[model samples]
Target: MRLMGLDYGDKTIGVAISDELGWTAQGVETIRRTNRKADMKRLGELIREHQVEEIVVGLPKNMNGTIGPRGELSMEFAEQLQNTFKLPVHLWDERLTSIAAERTLLEADVSRKKRKQVIDKMAAMLILQGYMDSKKRR
Candidate 1:
């Protein structure tokens, strides 16, 4: 089964997808969030087009492992996803994933402005990649 990964942010939703074998992840398009309804509409199209089976959303938590405002918002997004698509939605811990993505982009010589534009999508890729790797080890 295929899975779509998301990094939910205030203004954008980073997107990634698992490989057909569900063993790898690749960066996909990022969805610019307008409103809940608009975001869901765009996600529905992606789900249909990609033949997605499940969704994996990044769950942001505070450094001390507590849910903050962002984490609560992510949960809300996951609920909407489940309600609309009727598919299982997994919330994967994503603390520091964006930081890791930022460091990676820096190492790759990506410009600051460009990194800002794509960091969310890259973070989603990291989250999806981590999930895929763990599944492989299982």
Candidate 2:
């Protein structure tokens, strides 16, 4: 079954999709946040287009492993997605995934402007790949 991954942020939501075999994920696009209706609409379109069967949303937690406001928001978003799409949604611990993505961009010498544009998308890929890797180990 195909899966979709998301890094939900304040301004944008990064999207990634798994391969048919569910082994790898690739960055798809970044959806700029507008409003709830609009955001869900776009996500739904991508879901349909990609024929996604499941969703994995990154859940940002504090260093102490406590769920903070951001984590709460991610949980709510995941619930909404599950309700709206009627697909299973899983929240993957996403602490520092963004930081890792930033470091990777810096190592690649990506320009600041470009890095800002794609950081979320890259993070989503990391989150999805991590989840898929965990599943593989099982």
Best prediction by lDDT: 2
- The model with the greatest TM-score is 2
lDDT of 2 at 124: 96
Give the per-residue lDDT digits (tens) of candidate 1, residues 18-54: 8788988888888998998899999999889889999
lDDT of 2 at 84: 99
lDDT of 2: 0.96
129, model 1: CA deviation in Å?
A: 1.1
**TM-scores of the models, in the order given:** 0.96, 0.98
Q: List per-candidate RMSD values in Å.
A: 0.9, 0.6
Q: Which ten residues in a row have the lowest lDDT in candidate 1?
A: 129-138
Model 1: colliding residue pairs:
none
Worst 10 residues of 2 by lDDT: 27-36
Distance from true position, residue 62, model 1, in Å? 1.2
